[model samples]
Target: MTVKGVDVASYQPTDYSTKGLDFVFIKITEGRTYTNPKWVDQRQTARDADLVTGFYHFVRPGSMTAQADYFMSRINLVKGDMLALDWEDTGVSNAEKDSFIKYVQKKRPHTRVLLYCSRDFWLNRDTTSFAGDGLWIAYHNGKPGEPGIKHPWRFHQYKTTPMDTNTGRFDDKAALREWARSKTP
Candidate 1:
């Protein structure tokens, strides 16, 4: 079975906690200078709704370590919480992406790091070297599986218009919980 979830940034916080959503990935930071002002409240609401919560950082085109440090400073993540890097900019090199992921992992050794990128972007940009614990492939084709994605993806963002809809590729919520539990320190 596929577990449904949604990713939210400050711009998309309206009605963020609808029923039946199993998880939420909220934007915590962008680059080295910006933190989502509403992340704390959004996270609280998501938790109150009993959804598994994760955080993501929108990478910028600068010092990878500084960016990672900026992201680390903004949010307090507990065990079982996921972390993601939203990589979409063609300007950012693969080496930079790798360094950023490594920097974040070095800081938070036990947290699961997911690489979020669109299927087209991932393929077209030749980003196979961008390493992470799992893939969060975004393919807005209103379909389930991404046809030619080389790596295994744990989450797939299948839609984005009305809301960013995702499906967790797990047997059930219990399995996803177990996966998160195992990844957490």
Candidate 2:
């Protein structure tokens, strides 16, 4: 079976409920300049609720290492906490995405560093199909786990409105947690 989750950015409320979610991917940084204003409290809330927490960085035009450094230096990550690279910027190249993933992997060899992108981006822009540990695809098909693509995915953000809803490719929440800390996601 698949596990349900949500992804949130600074715009979302920190006091949101976790009644039905097994995980939460919170945007922590964008580029090297902005850090999600609500990250600390939102992350704390997820931890308090025992939801698998994930943090993502929105890529921008600049030094990949500097951005990684900026992102890594801001938060204290624990086990089962995922790290993802948001690849939506039109200016950032595919090579940069791969570089960022590689940089993060070198730093946290055991942690999962996922790639977040739309189906269009993956089909048209992607050249390497290198989504680090896994791909967190945004394909609003209403049917979760169906990204409509042959490429393997770990999480599917199958809907966006009413907040970005997702379904993970895990046997259950326990498997999700195990993959979060394991290199095999």
Candidate 3:
């Protein structure tokens, strides 16, 4: 099985050789907390690692435009990578959700999007309008199986390890990527 990559935050090793990864998803911030102590020093950790690095925000379902503006302020998004929205149960309005996506696309036209959430959350979502947007689904387990979701996901965060600083060890990045590539437009 081909191992694709891993996601790390600012505190971990910035150098890539430690993991020999292909891609990385780094957390820039969540809500008003812009300063991650670990991310402060290793801002270019993923680039240094020679990995296809991407950034994501832990969103709280607010004014979509305001949230997008906040994200654009801090993140210097690299081209040819995804800018993900880590959605949680923040009781966000549907209008806000639509506006958020529209604003983000307007600001970063080339940026692909991923709507990430857990399986339970996915089942409970009202994301009918948000379909066709790429997904980075999170479902943690120790092994592989046919992922259970009514909606299709671009990638799945399956198989975890204790070594994770942000989340857990997702040992299926490569498989997820391959699946996403095959499925994505």
Candidate 4:
């Protein structure tokens, strides 16, 4: 049992349809200064469609705590909205990624925080298996939810079929919503 999702960025349109999607993770902030110009409308698009909403930050080389603080400050976060750290920037080290996740978790107790990274980074670069709530592996193939890593992942961004499609490790939308509220892996 799984739920379909998509991770959207500024380049994506604001009136993103959520016909068959259960959740959406929109890019909120990048580094410490940049915010996704379309995030508010994208979030509203998800909200109006009644899909579970998530927000993520593109991690950069900086103080993890400060970045986490800045990310938290930018979003009007609610308890059930998922949070993620997009660790695709080559400048971001494994330690910094983990630190940012940890800092976010510490600041917002009982909140779900996830790490989004490529397969190469997870396999070759990661030193600690320290994804906060679960790892959202970004490995695109014909198959969804098959990241090819042994890490106990909870989400898989399988392809960019027009949009970044994903599969969540859950029974259904109800279960995902319950888990999102609980912030459990």
Candidate 5:
């Protein structure tokens, strides 16, 4: 069975659990400055709803270490919580992306780092330099397999209607749930 999940920012704070989502990835920070003001409440709500929770940082052009430090300082991740870097900014370089991923890994070796990028952006920007542990490919089209992505993706954001809909690569809900639970600190 495909495990359904949603990636949400401050702009989209509606309780997605009612929509039948099994997990959620919330945006915690953007660059080195902006923190989602609603993150605490949103996170609590998601947790209260028993949704497997994760956090993501929107990458911006700047010192990769600084950005990583900012993100790390803000998030309180445990084992089983997914961590991701949203690499949508075209201004960010491959080196910066690599540095960010490496810094996150060095700081939290137990946490799985996911790189979130669109298929078009990944191919156009040539983001093979990203060294995150998993991929969260965002392809708006219904089909994500046609992207020809060389990396094995764990999560695929295949739709944005109603909210961002995703499918995990796991074989069953139990397996995916086990994977999520194992990510805890």
Candidate 6:
């Protein structure tokens, strides 16, 4: 089954209804510094659209604990399926990365903590060792490019219709729901 989803932040899908979107992974925080501007709206929109939403935090090795705590504080996880950590090497030490992932796994055992990274990260580094848990691969190979990750992915952000940009209209809700149910346990 193809897992369908939407990756959201402040600017990208602002004001857009996620009526047809299946799993929504909204950015809750980036390390200890940034938070999506429309994070609240995005969460509410996903819920109103009846989509299963998960909150993801961008990890910064130096501030791992702070970032994790920030995410746990901001996101309303009652409707969320998991906690995601997105890390990009910006001087983040391997030790720090390992510590952060381990902390999240132990703290939120009930909810899956997934790692989202590009193929370069997965192939070139020790990321696969962590894949024993699970990984959300982001690989795109389209001309115009898709909204979320592309091609071979654990989860794909296949289509996107701007909620605010539309005249408040959407058409893919049923298809998205059906697709979501098929992939989810």
**Alpha-carbon TM-score of each model against the true structure:** 0.93, 0.97, 0.73, 0.96, 0.89, 0.72
lDDT of 2 by residue, 1-185 (tens): 99999999988999877888999999999999999999999998899989999999999988999999999998888977999999999888999999999999899887899999999999999999999999999989898988988998999999988899999999999999998877742
What TM-score number comes out for model 2? 0.97
Which candidate tops TM-score? 2
The CA lDDT at 94 in model 6 is 55
- List residue ranges in candidate 2 displaced over 4 A: none
Output the lDDT of residue 6, model 5.
82
Between candidates 3 and 6, name the one with more favorable lDDT: 6
Order of the predicted models by lDDT, top scorer first: 2, 4, 1, 5, 6, 3
lDDT of 4 by residue, 1-185 (tens): 89999989999999987999999999999888999999999999999988888899998897888788888998777768989999998888877888899889888777899999989999988999899888999999859878899989999999987999999999999899898898643
Candidate 6's TM-score: 0.72
Instruction: Give the alpha carbon lDDT tens digit for every residue of 1-185 in model 3.
Output: 43455565655665534365656676676665464456534546666655555567777655666667777678666555567776765576545555666677677776666666667666766555473256666677634333476565555666556433122123455543443343223
Name the 10 consecutive residues with the lowest summed lDDT in model 4: 176-185
Off by more than 4 A, model 4: none
lDDT, model 6: 0.58
- The 10 consecutive residues of candidate 6 with the worst lDDT sum are 162-171
**Ranking 2 against 4 by lDDT, winner:** 2
Give the winner by TM-score: 2 or 4. Answer: 2
Q: How accurate locally is residue 167 in candidate 3, as Cα lDDT from 0 to 100?
A: 26
Pairs in steric clash, model 6: 15-164, 16-163, 16-164, 17-163, 20-173
Candidate 6 residue runs with Cα over 4 Å from true position: 17-19, 143-153, 156-185
Off by over 4 Å in 5: 127-131, 144-150, 181-185
Model 1, 96-145: lDDT tens digits are 88888877877888888888888887778844546588888898888866
lDDT of 5 at 54: 81
What tens digits encode model 6's per-residue C-alpha lDDT throughout 1-185? 23345677777655665644456778878877788888888778877877666677887767777777877777655623566777676566556666777787676655656666655665666433563144665545331123232333344332245321111012354543433333332
Show the colliding residue pairs in model 3.
10-38, 10-39, 161-169
Worst 10 residues of 3 by lDDT: 162-171
Off by over 4 Å in 3: 1-3, 10-18, 40-43, 93-95, 129-132, 144-146, 163-185
